[model samples]
Target: MVVATRELPASGYALEVDGRFKAEFATRDGARAGAEELKKRFPMLQVRIYDALTRAREDVQLPRA
Candidate 1:
């Protein structure tokens, strides 16, 4: 039997909601865009973008009403 393991890129970005990973993107802009859309649909959920290279998390602020 053979198994395959997926490798993630060093510059990849990850979208996190409420401390849980929701999606992954090849670019930071893509991840940010995804977070924004999710924030728009669910105003109560906490959205963030995580950088795999720096091992940091950036909080996404909601737009002003």
Candidate 2:
């Protein structure tokens, strides 16, 4: 499993798996722990996790602008 994370301006963190939906955390430590837990639970999923803020920024906007 591959876990990734990014820090938010509000002193929190965002986490995700396999480039899917994200989970917000109160702190980076919490995010790391969450990612590790996910890996342990889904060891065979080939997880690719990342933070929400950066990912959201990169994602396409809705409503076609």
**Which candidate has the highest TM-score of all?**
1
lDDT of 2: 0.48
Model 2 Cα shift for residue 7 (angstroms): 14
Q: What is the C-alpha lDDT profile of model 1 across 13-35, one tens digit per residue?
A: 88777877767787888888888
Alpha carbon lDDT at 14, candidate 1: 80
Model 1 lDDT at residue 13: 83
User: Which run of 10 residues does model 1 get worst, by summed lDDT?
Assistant: 1-10
TM-score of each: 0.79, 0.50
51 in model 1: Cα distance from truth in Å? 0.3
TM-score of 1: 0.79
| Model 2, span 24-60: residue lDDT tens | 6665567667666766776654333333445432222
Return the number of clashes found in candidate 1.
0
Residue 21, model 2: lDDT of: 44
